[model samples]
Target: MKFKVMAFLVAMAAAVPAFAQQAGPTTDLAKLEGGVFTVDKGHAKILFSYSHFGYSTSYGLFTDFDAKLTFDPKAPTSSTLEATINLDGIETMVAKLNEHLKTPDFFDTAKFPSASFKSTKITVISPTTGTVTGDLTLHGVTKPVTLDVTFNGGGTNMAKKYDLGFNATGHVKRSDFGLGAYVPMVGDDIALTISAEFNRVQ
Candidate 1:
């Protein structure tokens, strides 16, 4: 038993260095690859929340989404992005609520089907932070919105692909998009948060 324990400990010690050598994304812009990248859907998510009658906050998210990013290392402000979210993919973790959200009272997935955003401007505030102004189309209405974005990191992943990660937050008036169902009772202002990872495709 002593010999077996010793062998296991030795093997575990040897693996530590290997694990340490494996690199993930980093917060270094100089190392980021400049090109077109596609969202790594498996590593990305879009979440939204709103006040519920001032009692609590209700949260939900869209699971099926895709985005394409155009990055320029030399001129970061020139970067742009386009994304689409399937309205039918909304999830609140409650089966009935999820189905209700798809009804006309809320998103009305049958009519809109999807929401999309196309960035019109990218402003670099610093090495790792910026703002993105874009046209957001949701619930059959289009409006301009700006999102505060942070460049979380960039690096080459284990798959040998250049990966970049970002976090963005924004707010929109639900009524502006014709999504006002409960109004003040459910809240008209909606907050959106997005965390995504993009893998270089070009």
Candidate 2:
């Protein structure tokens, strides 16, 4: 019986490499065909960082948002993109601070409940990296901003659907958006990073 058990273990070990090479659920962006994709918000986030009185870099996230990607892998330059963010979903993990952010001094959700970005141009740097120039509308102001974006990967979800992932980073001055309440104290320079997943839509 012991000999049988030892043989079984060896057989399993021999088969491991074959199983490892079997196709798994990873998306290759280059292979993706042209189509429209929408954000899987459950797997997406917009993270922001700013200096707080020079004490530390405070972080926050917009909890609710939607994004779309129009991709033509063969001709990426023709692709366009758009995203809408709900200011009401802003969360800094601190209740008081979160409340203040939604008020007139900051986001003023009452006046502009949402912000949006619509890409005007896409500069492809390679198969997996590019620059996205778009109009970012925030606090009733619109400005041209560029984001350095990278295609992280593509994969299937629990539902077994094709999806793509990406990460992007950019910077903008809050004062330019008319949200200049704190200025130097709160840090006008805001850095942002986004991790987003988009599932193809018919």
lDDT of 2 by residue, 132-183 (tens): 9999999999999999999876655556676778899999999999999978
Please, what's the RMSD in Å of model 2?
3.9
Candidate 1 local lDDT, 124-201, one digit each (tens): 898889999999999889999999999888887777788899999999998998888888899899899999999999
What's the true lDDT of residue 178 in model 1?
A: 85
Count of backbone clashes, every candidate in sequence: 0, 2
Worst 10 residues of 1 by lDDT: 24-33
The alpha-carbon lDDT assigned to residue 99 of candidate 2 equals 96
Q: Considering summed lDDT, which 10 consecutive residues are worst modelled in model 2? A: 22-31
- Name model 1 segments beyond 4 Å from true: none
- Candidate 1, TM-score vs. the true structure? 0.93
Question: C-alpha displacement of 94 in model 2, angstroms?
Answer: 0.5
Question: Positional deviation of 74 in candidate 1, in angstroms?
Answer: 0.8
Off by over 4 Å in 2: 1-30, 155-158
**Cα deviation of 62, candidate 2, in Å:** 0.2
